[model samples]
Structure formats: structure tokens, C-alpha cells
Target chain A: MPLDLPNPTDLAVPGFIVLMLAEMIYGRMSGRAVYEGKDTLTSLLMGTGSVVAGLIPAGLGYGAAYYIWSEWRLFDLGHAWWVFVVAFVLDDLAYYWVHRFGHRMRWMWAAHVIHHSSQHYNLSTALRQTWTGKLTPGFIFALPLAFLGFEPAIIAFVSGINLIYQFWIHTEAIDRMPRWFEAVMNTPSHHRVHHATNPDYLDANYAGVFIIWDKMFGTFIPEDKANNPCRYGLVHDLGTFNPLRVAVHEWVGIVRDMWHAKGLKNKLMFLIGPPGWTPDGSRMTSDMIKEDWKRRQAVKEAAPANIAAE
Target chain B: MSLLQLLGSVIAVFIVAAIARWLFPVRFRLEDAHLHRELERVYPDLEPEEILIDRAGNAALLRLSGARGIVVVRRLGDKAVLRHWMPGTKVTATRTPTGLMLDTDDFTEPKIVLDLDAEGVSRTESWLALLAAPDGHAHAA
Candidate 1:
């Protein structure tokens, strides 16, 4: 079969439907609401957009890798099996960095924020992905796998497995496990922390299947139900279920802020600053913008009546 | 497969094993003995009236009904946080004379089973049930 041809994993239609059904069942069982009309439709649309965008480049990358690896047999590496293993790990390791960067960089966050836009964390939230994400800087990670002499099919399969493992962790149904399991692997608790908008938990855990990367890099934060409740969604919610708005909301916000910026430094800050970071004279972080707005309103109301009465 | 291929296959198998261990993982459950011991330590005052283990053995749902009310502690991993609470109202009150009937509808809705024992019973079961009704209160409408 031609490497570029669609495979079972590529046609994730069945998996997507199954995921929706599972989310509904699990959500109801856990006393959480299932898809509420428009949100369900919006999530489906946004997820479809993300998948379409992601597949195009991914398909091209796979075809190129397959051609090169099958033709050049670049390394004198003796075992086909060993080559596959190394390629898979290397891809995952690269994925860890890519996933980390997606959170750290504003440009990447525009695409990634779709996944976190849901206020209620459920399986549908997992499907609320961004089609524009593949256009980000780190999609280049596939090149390294290509250079490493692994067939694109193998690379794609390994990447698919990594993604599949992430699905079940999207639930609140499963809690903690054995100490050793949690200490090493990324459990539901760890992922819950990752999805939380709490300052203490924001961007703390960024592992895929193995949390060793987060632990090693010092990004891991254990779930503390007492001190840190997992509040789902971003600090400033989009407040709408429109997929177009969800996909480009941050990008639009970035452009507007950049345009209003008074200086080159502020303009750059608008682009590169953390998701909520802003350059207004008030020096308010994006996460605190709503609070600042309320505080300003309160101050306005508290001003001396005579001064305004004139 | 030649000697070189054999060596390569062995190496490949180990690498795949490591990746599998990293992803699509299997985890160890918190043993019932350990969970009982921890619950005892956390809530030394109340005795565990009943312990319900899920079929998968991944989580243990403990119900501690005392004079205070009902305390549901879900034990997952090393943590046994307060999962649900109902206070002041007798557990028997919610249960019919035959015992609390298992309503599949209850499982269908998203209800916050409060830890009433800790803070006192602030809301009634009927109130909570209404709040959790699937007519869609949780979603931002």
C-alpha cells in the first residue's frame, strides 16, 4: 500500500463517535452533564477542523519519510525492530517538547487553546482540538524522525499510539492509583492538574503517557484536591460555543492588542507574551484582567460624588 | 532473520517494551487493606460503615454514615479526598424503608454529592437532585 494512502487510524471517524458515546456515558455516570446542544455541535466542528489541518501535513511528512527510509536504508543498523523502537521513543520525546512549547508560546497557544476552552472537562473537551495547530513551528519534529531513517508509516503509527493513550486520561471518573504508578506514569490526577486554570496548576504537568519528562523537568504538580481544586477551562472563558470563534479567538485578540500597542516592545509582548499577559499601563496579567476590570469599576463607583456631580 | 537481524529484533523488542510501559499503560490499584488503613487515619472519629469497590478495582467508594450524616470518600492512589457529603439528614431518610433504591437516573445526572458531615447539611437531597437534573444546568446556556 502506498504510504500516503489513508489507514484505519487516519479515518478516526469511528473512534471519534465512540469517544463521544463514551463521554456521554461517563459524564452522566459521574454526575457531569453531557454535550449541551450547541457545545456538542461546536466541539465536533472544531475537532473536525483540527483533524483536517493536522492530517494534510502529517500525510505529506509520512510519505516523504517512507520513501527515504525504504530507499536509502541509511543506517547500517542491523535490526528493523530496534530501528522502529528508537524511532518511536525519539518521536515521543520530541512530542513532549512540542507539547510543552505549545503551552509556552502564544502563537502555538492560539491553536491549542481550543482544547482547553471547555469550562466543563469531559471527553468532548478532549475532542475540542485546533486544526491550525499543525501549522505551528514544532510540526517540524517529524523531520528528525525522517532524518533518523524510520519509515513514515512506523513514525505515524507510533504517534497515533501516543495520542490514543491520552484519550482515557481526559476523565474524572478515574482517580489516583498505586504510588509507584503515579510517581512514574501520567495518571488522571496528573492530567487533571494539566487542564486546571488555577495559578498553582497552570502549565505544571505537560507529560503525554510518561510523566517522567515533567518530573525530570520540574513541571510536575501532584493533584491536591484540598489546596488546588481542578477548575476546568481557561481563566478567561470564551463564553461562546462557536468553533470559528474558539479557533481564532486568541489570534484575533493577539492582533487587536498588537495593533493598539504604543511601542515595538509592547507589540512584541502582545505576540510573545504568555496567553494572558498584556502590555497595558496597569501591568495586569491576562489571567487577572477580569478582576482588574471589576476593581476599576468599583473604584469609579467609589469616587467622590461632588467631583463627578460638577 | 540473520544473526544481525536477530540482534536487531531483540534490541527492538526491548525498546518497544519501554515505550509500551510509557504509553498505553497498566497501573496498580490501591489495595483494599491500604485504603481501609488510610481512611482510618484520615477520619479517625468516624468508622467506615461500608466500602464499595468498583468492578475494575481502580477506585474504592467508602460510605461512613454516623450521627453526623453521610461521608463518601473516594480513594484513588495515595489520596482519599472527600468525594461527597450529606449531613444532618439521616442516610435512612433518603433510603426507602427497603433501602436506597438504585435509580439508574441518579447515575445519569451530574450531581455533587456534598460532604455534609464536614460542614453540616446545607442542602437537601431533593435540592441537589433538582440541581443535578439532566435538563442541562451545568452547561453555560
Candidate 2:
């Protein structure tokens, strides 16, 4: 059944622009937000490229999703107000898992890394959408929703709202929200940690709309900016402003690693292993990096204690 | 995505980026103190002995204090990244007519070119010698 719903993301475009302009003005006066011309341009172009990619190649994802929904659905969950609510919650849960995989699995990270390529976090940084997300298996998480008989059109609409909700959380302007809000929702504070490269903050806070998902799982890390400041970007920061490079650099990395890898097993691991995986452990994954920091902290603390005992 | 929408988005990209550039005119300049702070932030507890900056002050090499390697800092745009080039890491530091160029065995930063003058070139000669030895590891205090 063709639902006559307009894409909510499309309608929100003007709001995104206006909010960005407002944020820029606020950043100018308050010094809370950071903006660089080249960074903003790169991010916006990525967003535009994402739209284009969705229109052209993303048909495969949309097609597959609806196929499962129409033919394989358990029940014909017709349009209802409550269906939207159920779709929103279930889709968010799916997002949590998919997003977790996006960070953990190398194949998915190739598609997702564009959003994290920026060294600075602000409203513009939120505009850095993935260009090749349709190619990856990230959409598989949403397929269950389709199977559960939620219309793909409805899923599409709510998922758009999920994304829209996330945009405002990309700023540094707002500190902590109200204590109640902070506990329940993913605020700018929580999302900042998600973007940070700081060892302690890496591979954490993968929430779309609700911070509770992260808390329910073990992925939540509170924003501790006092002790350790957030340094945004990937482990190996891309030092280029070219949106093309930003979009496909990780995909290139995966191919390069696979070609150089020794055995077929190792090559497969290069694709499936966590980002920064190596056979000899020459490179540090996020987990390894975090462990290194913990080890360093222990050594530093132990040194003083040893001296005091002596 | 309509043709009109796509064209409008392209135009908006320029307008937004321009507005950002206008508001934040000056990117973070790499002064010695600022560079020191940034290096410390990236590499916690790794103290640098000397900060060797180029004439342009765009790029710098921090000779680690009582350590086995140098930390390289290069500007991306307004932001700079601090990467460690430790001993046993194959960093081919050679002097060219242009400047002292380093072929770093790093995925992100494959090559590093340090713009240098005559005096700068002469000073980097020692760095070339230190990094080029068969051992290729300089243990300094």
C-alpha cells in the first residue's frame, strides 16, 4: 500500500539551515561552538551526497526492506497511530544494534566513518552523513521491523524523525540538560563522548534518540569533560577537506588492508574484524587503546606509590 | 530529491560554509604554547623536549624528552594531529632541495615535508643522521 506521506527529512531541510545559521551566530558571540569554513562545506556536501546516493543507489535497500514487509510479514499491520509509536521504539532498538556494529565491524565502519571524520563537533558536523550506507548490511537491522509487519514507509518516516532528533545533540553550545533529561535522553553532552577519540570515551554512547539504550547496555559513558577533554575525530584523522576522500577513505582502507593481508582468513578478518585490527597486533583497536590508557594510568599511579614506600 | 532541491542544497552548502568562514575568520594558529597544549592533549604524559617548527609555523616535530622517537604535528586545516614516529618505525628522514622530507610508514600520514631554511636545513641534518643510522633508534635524555 502506497502511503501518501512526505519524507519528513525533506521537510526539515529549511529548519536545518536556519538552525545552523543561528548556531553560527551563537558560536560567534558565545565562543561555545566551533566552526571552520572548510569543515562546514565538507560536512554539508557529504549530506547532499547522501541525499543523492539515497535517491539513486539506495533503492536496493528500500526495495529489499519493503519486499520483506509485503511478502514475508507476519501480520498486515495496517496504518494506526499506535503503530507509529511501536515502530519508533522498535526501530530505535534496531538502530542501537546496527550503530554498535557500525563502530565494531570494519565493513559497516567504512560506510559510517564519514560522520566521524570531522575533528571539530558542531551543528555542521551533524550534517556529515554517510554516502555508501545503502551498500552495507546496516539496513538489515530495519528488516525485522518490516517482518514484524510495520510498513517500510512508516519505518522510513519515523527513522527520519530519529535522525532529525539526533541533529540538535551535535552541538557544544549546551552543557548538561536537566538531570532528568540527561538520564533519559541523549543530550549534546552524551553525544559529544560518542564523537570523541579519547581512549576512555571511544566505542561508547551509541544511542540515537534515547540515552537509556546505552545505559541498559554497558556502552554508556558519562560526559567527564573536566578530567579528560573530548578530542573529536577517528584514530587516524583524515587531514583532507575533500568530501570525496572523506566519504570513501575507510572503504579504501579496507581494500588496501585486505590486499596486503597474508592468508584468506586474515583477509576476511580485515573486513569483519573491528577497526584497527591486525594479525600481529601492530595496530591498536579501540579496546586495545583503552587498555593502554588504563595500563598507563596504573603505571603512573604505581610509580608514586613505589617511591612513597621506598 | 528533485533537481530544484539538489541545486538549492548545493547553493546552500556554499552559503553555509561562507557564513561559517566569515564568523570564524581565523583558524587556530600554531604558536609554540598552543602546539604544546595540543600535543599534551593527544599524547598524555609524553613530554616533548624541543618543539622544532618550520619558518611557516604550519608544521612541527616534537623531539620527545628521554624517549625513543619524535612526535610529528601537521596542520589539516585549522586543526593539527600529533602522531608518534617511534624508533624501529621506518621513517626515512632525508634532506631535499625543497626541505627535509620524511617518508613516514603511517597509514594516515604517509609523507611529511618540513619546510626549512639554510639554518633549519643544517639543524635537520642531525635529525637525518639520528633517524638514518642502521639502528634507527635515538635514545636521548
Each model's Cα RMSD: 17.5, 2.9
| CAPRI quality of model 2 | medium
TM-score of 1: 0.57
How well is each residue in B39-141 modelled by candidate 2, as lDDT tens digits?
Answer: 7677776788777898767788877766556777888778887787665556677777878887754555646778898788776656555555556444464
* Candidate 2 lDDT over residue span A47-139, tens digit each: 999988878745767888889988999988899999999999998899999999999999999999999999989988998999999878888
Q: RMSD to the native, candidate 2? A: 2.9
Lowest lDDT 10-residue stretch of candidate 2 chain A:
A53-62
Q: Which digits, one per residue and each the tens of the lDDT, describe model 1 over residues A219-307?
A: 88899987657876665555355567778887877787789888999888777676667665443353465465457557778787757
Write down the DockQ of candidate 2.
Answer: 0.57
Clashing pairs in 2: none
Name the runs in model 1 displaced over 4 angstroms: A1-8, A11-13, A30-35, A55-79, A263-265, A280-310, B1-141
Tell me the tens digit of each residue's lDDT in model 1 across B19-103: 3233323344545686667555334456665555433444444545442333343322223333333332223224333222222
**Clashing pairs in model 1?**
A31-B110, A32-B110, A50-A131, A176-B77, A177-B77, A276-A286, B85-B114, B85-B115, B85-B116, B86-B116
